[model samples]
Target: MTCGRPMFPGSTTEDQLHLIFKVIGTPTDDTWPGIIYSEEFRGYNFPHYRPDPLINHAPRLDAEGLSLLAEFLQVGPTAQHFLMVAISEAVFESFGAAVQRLSDLSSLFEVSGISLHKNPGLRSSATLTGRSRQGR
Candidate 1:
């Protein structure tokens, strides 16, 4: 029932995130507001995470190839669960494609449990999207 939360930093993030620190190659501000993540201590913060190289897939990687990628991600000794890239689609048909692959992706993530969600103030079921509910 939780809408996976919107990252919503808007254009500011798009602009500021890649900005090099005037003094250094990194940013002067430790945090950039509107960076979407699960961290508390609400304030300015930038993307501070990196995928485990051993556990990550290069862009455009396919599902089966992602299996070994996920394994490497879960390979650390600690029981900590790391990150998974968020994937979104535009319409109901696209959503259908996402649901179809959820299993294989879950297997790659090495967990049986997952929940598909969307932004709040939106329908929980795919049936309510766009023109369907609008009668347009």
Candidate 2:
């Protein structure tokens, strides 16, 4: 859903594809570098449609909110703005407080020598069982 309405609501895949194109339109080198060279994007047989503005698609969002959302929704992994930049740009009234709190927490975590990296097997049942047994 763009805001609340379905962006590509259809019974068939074709209809959905059409709607998808309508919303995003075509991605060019300027908008998305190297997209034209991707296997899926190359030699495609589809109708070209222009992109509808984010506001037009999601009328409920204000310009600032939409700008932030657009940054987050970039197609390329590197195209998206950094979290810090996005937050600063959005500039919530409590941003300073939030950043200070985060910094304090990070310092505490660093002093404790606890790595922030997530354990790859965290979701496995075996890991949970082992941890539970250790607690006993």
When summed lDDT is taken over every stretch of 10 residues in candidate 2, the lowest stretch is 124-133
Q: What TM-score, over all chains together, does every model reach?
A: 0.17, 0.47
Q: Residue 125 deviation, candidate 1, in Å?
A: 40
**Tens-digit lDDT track of model 2 for 1-136:** 2333345686776666667667777666777788878876665645667777878766666787678666655555565345446545523322233432345235323322222332365432111112222345
Query: Quick one: best TM-score, which candidate?
Result: 2
Q: What does candidate 1's lDDT look like per residue over 1-136, in tens digits?
A: 1123321223565444323221112222223323234343224454444433321223334564355334323422221333232332232233334333555336322322232435455444222233232444
How does residue 117 of candidate 2 score in lDDT? 37
What pairs collide in candidate 2?
none
What would the TM-score be for candidate 1 when compared with the true structure?
A: 0.17
Q: Candidate 2, 24: how far from true, in Å?
A: 2.5
